[model samples]
Target: MQLANKTIVVTGAGGGIGRELCLQLVQRGANVAGVDINLATLDETGRLAGVGRDRFAGFQLDITDGEKVSSLPAEVLAHFGVVDGLINNAGIIQPFKLVNDLSMDAINRVMAVNFYGTLYLTKAFLPHLLERPEAHIANVSSMGGFLPVPGQTVYGAAKAAVKLLTEGLYAELKDTNVKVTVIFPGAIATNIMQNSGLDVPNADAGSDSQFKTLSARQAADQMLAGIEKNQFRVVIGQDARAMDKLYRLNPKYAADLIQKKMRSLLR
Candidate 1:
């Protein structure tokens, strides 16, 4: 699971934690195949990585497209000659609304991006990964995946699916060389709201926000640590770590607390 001299494929490489992961993976002496839907931004990630073509390659891909996702393994292998790791990092948040108020289209989009998208890439690359002497698969779930946040109910559900899927993969692959990790990240400073086609309600009220936001780079660093160490799970931020413990200790209290904290975000 050491990153050095490995070929790691990271989705969502256009921005945020995915972009940072690509940069850091190369810094750790690994070649990276960076995937994202945005060509211009994915190219920017390649530029920012500042590595040679052999060290970094940007692939513009929509993970939701099963056909395209299935072909990615061959494409990436043609460039890197091998796939050593797969990090399912691309995801989108739901519009801030209760499930009753949200449209079916909105719910489906979130699931497509967060759950099925990860599933497609995982299924596509898992066989190749199994062939490696050592390989890693890390799926990025959310803190909300394990706890209920009233407004983002469906988003949480999709992430919850990812959480279970990753856990199952870990258990099934326990006897194999392919290591699996499930990543739970707390709030971090990124453009997820805008990317999700919405805006933060209290944009100018960072000081008043209850949760502390970590930098995207910090999140990427911690996420990759799980893979390097071959850990089964990695919780990135204080907010997520605290909630994980609280939810395990008192589910009802944890659920109520998050609902109260998240009320303002709902329409």
Candidate 2:
């Protein structure tokens, strides 16, 4: 989708990939309505967006709030006058723990934000998007969504739902003017671990690995390219591409094989 003159709404715009996405969208000449639960972070995103007051704005919102999410289309319409694209990027990862050891509350929180939040926002915005001749929706899933990590079971489950949900949206919207894309990112260097309420030791370990994690800017760049191509799925980073290939070739073996290699990183 050509971003010029489009009004795009990006959730989780306070930090991490969400922040970078806003910056990139503005650079590409898109008007952005940045949304996040954290007002301070949203302000930072707005500053980074650097578009004039008319083209760049921030909204404080928790995507998991169905009532609030349902009410957003009108607000966005008022701000930008129309909604053309949406990036379902707001997400949270609960504490890294095995399924049996994980708390029910944690699991629920993860699902509420990662899965239901995306669903709510997408449903709320689909009608508005349909009105536009060239609209787009991009949902950010993780490599963990496709290849489960033992400790991050709940996060994996939530992102897995996002992956499938986006794919289904893509299939259903095949005949529509609205384009749908699902993004699977490898271990991008971001504050996701710290935000997950976990301590990340040697977070840089994956930075320069052969299966390198990407910077947020790189990930956002690829996402824009995917949107332009109208790709159904876009996998970012070396590790993400490798995992996608492995899982497609041998699902069972890919899981075990990845776990064996990644377990050492935790230690």
- Identify the candidate with maximal lDDT: 1
List model 1 lDDT by residue over 1-267, tens digit each.
899999999999999998999999999999999999999989999999998899999889999999999999999999999999999999999877888899999999999999999999999999999999999999999998999988889999999999999999999999999999999998888888877888777624335656779999999989888789998899989889999999999999999887767766663
- In model 2, how large is the Cα lDDT of residue 136? 97
> What is residue 144's positional error in candidate 2, in angstroms?
1.2
Q: Which portions of model 1 miss their true places by more than 4 Å?
A: 203-211
lDDT scores of the candidates, listed in order: 0.92, 0.87
> Please, what are the lDDT tens digits per residue for candidate 2 over residues 1-267?
999889999998889888998898898889999999889989988887766768889989988899999999999898789999999988887775568888898899899999999999999999999999889999999988999776777899899999999999989999999999999988787898776677765534454467756788888889888987888899899888998998999999988976666564555
Please report, as a residue range, the 10-residue window in candidate 1 with the lowest summed lDDT.
Answer: 202-211
Assess candidate 1 and give its lDDT.
0.92
Residue pairs clashing, model 2:
none
**Per-candidate total of colliding backbone pairs:** 0, 0
